[model samples]
Target chain A: MEILALFGDFTVRTVAIGAALVGAVAGVLGSFALLRQQSLLGDTLSHAALPGICLGFLIAGSRRLEPILAGALVTGAAAALLVLLLTRTTRIKSDAALGVSLSLFFAFGTVLLTYVQRHAGAAQAGLDAFLFGQAAALVPRDLVVLAVVGGGSLLVVALGWKELKITTFDADFARSLGRPVVLIEFLLTVLIALAVVIGLQLVGVILMVALVIAPAAAARQWARRLEGMVVLAAVFGATSGVVGALVSASIRGLSTGPVIVLVASAIVVASLLLAPERGALWQLAHAFAQRRSLRAHRVLVDLYRLAQDHDDLDYASEQGMLDTYFGRRTGHVLRRLERRGLVSRAHHMPEEGTHWVLTVDGRQQARELIRPFGERDTTLDGATQ
Target chain B: MTGLQGWLDQPGVTIVLVGALVGVAASLLGAFLVLRRESMLSDAISHSVLIGIVLAYLITGALDTPLHVVGAALAGLLTVWLTDVLVRSRRVKSDAAIGLVFPALFAVAVLLINVYARDVHLDTDAVLLGEIGFAWLDVVRVGPLEVARSLVTMLVITLVNLAFVVFLYKELKLATFDGMLATALGFRPGLVGYALLALVSVTAVGAFDAVGAILFVAFVIVPPTAAYLVTDRLWRMLVLGCVVAVGSSIGGYALAVAYDVSIGGAMASATGAFLLLALIVGKHGIVARALRRRAPRPPPVVHVPEAGGAP
Candidate 1:
């Protein structure tokens, strides 16, 4: 096949659909994983899938996607089981458990890979592509396998949604409520393994964890509910997958997994910056505007205090005196209040400098800040002037 | 007699030695990492070290220099620093920070190898998969004896790591178990922690030449974790970790030779087998618990009061 044949419309379509399916399934399951704080478990499961892929190839003596993915599911789930057992039974911490499983299984898989490479000879040419993944290798049959597995995992998630959610947030409470927490936890883990296996061909085992976590992590920025996070994650995952697969297909010598991971990471970056409520930039701007309002409130209250002390409602306090009182410049604060029609700037007669007086609206706001329902709003007093 | 002699000859001794030394060095450092809950940071450092090696080569135009080691160490620290920054930003969770930094750095390294260093020895296979099978081919001489370069490198590292543990035994122990107490006692626990991480990074660079990054992680984590199951004492854990590492190296080499598979990988898999073995047969293992449960207890001596009797 010519290299250009990789870019053929049909091939591109198949690859995109395959990647999207992988991404959506992983994203939905990954939301539960992330919420449960088992996000890194996805990384462990992917690393552990290599030996299974090699074993599957050895058992089938061909590149059949069905056997390959099935093999991945088995070992991946076994790795998760080992991790759970280790953490539950022994003194091993969760992070150590994750690392032990990921590395040992991956190493074991490399052994099988090499064994297959040496013994199977030329027939094993494309097998190592599973290392970094090659989307151009996707045939129509592979796509069918991906869809069946991906769709089945999603269906299981939908049917077991309530149990999964209950276990995720509070396993102890779920157990108290007579839910089979252990069984539910196991089911979720297995489902995550299946999602990871689904993504193995598109993103490969090396970087498949990013697909499992990135979409969910990104979606979490926009969502506060499990349902919304899951849905948004699925969408983000599918979009990144298709875009990455297409880019890899277009570029020569570029593998699919890294491209997809990079794209997914880019989405995470954008979401963290641009998401509405919880976005980093959004929060920063909100804090800044809040600080500005706080300062304006302080200046209004200060002007009110000065007028009352002089026994004149029209008393204008010089900016220099207010700065001395607040121990900082009040020009910017006064100007900001003037923009809001909260204060007016007047010329002090003796000194050629500006003085500030609160308008009627500013006085009312000041009264509320100082004597909120005749009770001090400590919220105003506590802030730095 | 001839079989033993043959096993001792050409590449066999060297391969096992190199694997064992790398395993030993990693486990010595890993005991602290596993205890400190920073095992994943080791994983992150191992992955990002690839970029350091590639960048070092690009600048120095040489592969056989200490610059690669230096570069790898710097890259490992960079991963740690970047993870810290991301977590501190409060936008990314600590776990996600680890997952994000290493893979991105690794991806960039792989892409760089694809674009610029394609013809060099820094291919994806050589860097990630490793070629410990050919370690014997490269030799350096000291005194009248010739040795595999990797073996020498790993030996120095293992001994240095041993020295580190021995010299700062109390400090590491204090920091691992009680950071606040150590801080109050005038031990700069944070500095000690960074020092330990730096050693782990250097050790990773040494082992990277033999077992690759993945297998090195297997060595670093599995043996130490298995040892944790077997013993509660730090000294005992350290020794048991080394024993597991060495045994795996020897056993794994035989398995590889018999099956024609990757030696480093088989060594790593052996460590996992030992962990499973520990899980089943150690003092705290399942069999002991099951036996204890089945064992008959002495009949309970009950102070029985007469029916309807009250004090």
Candidate 2:
């Protein structure tokens, strides 16, 4: 109750909301990134935004969020453009081009940051937090900025929905259909860059890739359709943001980004274990049930063979043999089988030790169970008909 | 002109030399990483080395030495191991696994530095940017000649890398080109992978002081990737990669001096520029071929009846 009350505090409440917005935006955009196999683009754009933020601070000369964010947006877009140019103009592969552009821009940003810190003496003027964000320090203005960026990104993505989806699924097809591939790709890249830049204010550059990759990855396992994937990815992202914010608010000195990543990680683990077909638990259970059915079929086949070879097999006498064959006690199970009317005691045998014989229904059930594993010609179904 | 001569003679020249040497070795190892489509792993390893550096400092009380290399190498290898573990045991995709491991490690390193090593200047800026400018300060004088320690170490690493690639060229090339084929040919692709990973780690460790962890990827990836566009044969690509790396290193230093920019950043940018130029102007450039090739035969004109008209 105390913790809940603490969480309700306005400081915690506002920050949590801001975190959620960031996650939601990232998740929605990240689904597109993952589907297109552009996972590392998140890392590239995040790093690329550093110089923008620095330049924003430099231009504005205050700890204000607006100019810094604007700087980040411009630089982020520029970096994406540079990467595109590299891919189109040069023979460099996308991955290599991404690496080159990312490192170069980021290193330049780091150098600027160092120079600012060293020469300006206003090093702690909210610039350092961009590298690894400090959620505890987020003010209401920061929240407002996050909202604007988040809402703006969402609006753009929503409007470009058809175009973005077409390009992502099949660029060639989109081109063939007269859709402007370059224009749509460029638009999507801008939206992606915007998402990355917004995330910088909350999670920072080092961990923003997690925001982009984890939720989308987790959502992919559960979703069969692309639309479902994007929606679920956003939900997972928002959940991680809220949960991570709560945990951070509860503890002193806990960075919000890492906690958010940890929360996202938890979601990934849960998805891996609980998703319908892809879940580990589902696979394990399926395998175990399969083995059980196989064993049961084997037991029935062996009993039928014994009955065929001899006049009858004593149920009580067979319990000992079943125990030896399967390495377990079978007397209780044998009684259950008798109750199910699948097997019966032989009248010729003594009452204390009853001999058993398969009923007509029991023989049919055994054949059904064993049919899948045997050769086609050996199947009993044709003979039965 | 005087400043240029002076700069060339100063120990800063040693920084460029060391940077170039490290660049060559890193790019050599980077070929396989790029081909295997694990280029980002270099970035992940580079970032995670901060934790290793900090831990090493705590344990050994040394700022930058062979011990630093050991710690960084261990950390890089651990990152690779952790990523693989996450991929195999936890069923996380490779990208997500890489994403998960590095930031966590980096955050721990940053927090540790903030809490314990604040007074000692043990921060990521130091670990990432390194003291390339100060490499001259720790010069080892041998009677008449003075050599930068970083340069000497990088030289040794460069030689080792050259030897490894030359002696095991066939195996390395075959394995990198096609792991399945290498395995079918009775070579353990896994061992080769480990060897390559270890080489990348060591190269990163050796280069950390001069170029730092962040820019190490630029060195490792840009050259080989650029070379890949121009050549098909592995041997030629290797040579071309080394040459491109060395050229970029020189150009980067000159550009940095001219523009008064970050030397490492400038070098990376130069390499990227070189790659772009190679990709565009080379004989196999997409635009060039598109221009040279004639259009295919025009599509057949099919007569279509108007909607709801003749069939």
Give the alpha carbon lDDT tens digit for every residue of B70-179 in model 2: 78778888999989987896555676678767876776776677556777866555566666767667666545566777877888899988898888888888888888
The digit string of per-residue lDDT tens for model 2 on A161-197 reads 8888889999999999999998888888888888888
What is the per-residue lDDT of model 1 for residues B11-92, given as tens digits with 9 covering 90 to 100? 8888998999999999999999999999988888888898898899889888868998889889998999988987897767
Write down the lDDT of every candidate, Cα atoms only. Answer: 0.86, 0.77
The candidate that wins on TM-score is 1
Q: Over 4 Å off in model 2, which ranges?
A: A1-9, A61-63, A118-124, A159-163, A170-181, A246-255, A311-317, A323-361, A371-385, B1-10, B51-97, B104-120, B138-149, B229-233, B250-261, B276-311
Clashing pairs in 1: none
What is the TM-score of chain A, computed separately for every candidate? Answer: 0.91, 0.87
Q: Cα deviation in Å at residue A272, candidate 1?
A: 2.4
Model 2: how far residue B79 lies from native, Å: 4.1
User: What TM-score do all the candidates reach, one by one?
Assistant: 0.91, 0.83
Per-residue C-alpha lDDT of model 1 across residues A38-137, encoded as one tens digit per residue: 8789989999999999999999998888889889999998889888877877667899989998998899899999999999878888878887788988
